[model samples]
Target: MIREEVKIISKEYLNKDVLKIRFEKPKEFQYKPGQFINIKFEQEGSFRMRAYSILNTPSEETLDICLKIIPNGLASESFKEAKENDKYTIIGPFGYFQLNENEKEHVFISTGTGVVPFINIIKEFVKKDYKMTLIAGYKKQENIICHEELKKIEQENKNFVYKPTITREEWGGLKGRVQKHLPENLSKKMFYICGLKEFVIETKESLLEKGVNEKYIKVERYN
Candidate 1:
């Protein structure tokens, strides 16, 4: 693992609160699709850090991270004050989430910015023969991130399916929490669930109750 200070390339807002920040990749940095980097920042009179999943594909030249800014959060303050050309100290590309090696369809369930890791993984999986399904939940239709890009990927790739659901607002696509309307044949496919603790726990429990094997499900909590 390498601790390096990298310069911010650019910053963009995916919606009203989500930030998609990119940094110039270090020359020797290497990590898998489902990994994250620990970002170091100065908070108050001391240093603090936050873990943000790598958002871009592994083959990309730059590292990207998408996160929702919780108002007055520790990392949120640093993210809010960040600008292009600012230097960010990053350490490690750490995570244990792995795609199942066996022949099974890939199912991803996530809410808000928890979809970050899957976004990175899907970019790698789409090139393979795996049949992938992504169900992303948001509070409203407008809060959806990577909307056009994911839709384009869905249209172009026959092996991939994208569903963007909403809870607090009416939408043309799917509606409700991720666990409320899960895809069919849950037992046969491998599951990856991410989001707040409740979201992860509820979805995992739902899958377990449906007879999906414990080994077939992987989960990550954002909050």
Candidate 2:
């Protein structure tokens, strides 16, 4: 991959742990919603690269990557200390998790930082006026990143529905794994799910159990 220099335009904590880092790339840098970019970082003996989803929409000039700061991982640790105006090498907007225009209703299910891709997708929906339903789950209430943003989107677009589920907390909304809320009537919609391996597998199973066609389900697994 040809590495390109992208400048860090801003950095903010979406949650206490999840960080959203916006970067400015060349004007022509373009990619689909669910695709990701390979981030290049320094290493002593070998090169270190990590794939992060492009969390910015076409309407936005600057590119962005929503990163979760791991306790001791090299990439996460480096990003934790990365300052504004710093430039880093980013290669490609890879992967095939992007949704198509023909797919009218999107059922996006994600856990933890896996919700990053859907954030971009929902942004596009708002810009182009499409319909989408988001179901995201986390371990606890405070751990839920992008809580306020999701609520705002839900309020802004009538077609946009946000359902936040928690595994360990009692909440007014759905209070279990996201699978518990998978719509029974899914014959006409497309599904995109992103999470860890187990979470993705279980979510796929739940969708299948509810009669969602296998072809309509797309998954992106992280670690």
lDDT agreement with native, every candidate: 0.89, 0.86
Give the poorly placed runs of model 1, Cα more than 4 Å off.
Answer: none
Task: For candidate 2, report its TM-score.
Answer: 0.93
In terms of lDDT, the poorest run of 10 residues in model 2 is: 122-131
Top TM-score hit = 1
TM-score of each: 0.97, 0.93
Residues 1-223, candidate 2: write the lDDT tens digits: 3469888989999878889999987777778888899999875566789999888786788888888888998889889989999878999878999876787788999999898899988887665656788899899898887789889988978998899899997877789989887776888899999989999999898888888899899999998
Colliding residue pairs in candidate 1: none
Clashes of 1: 0
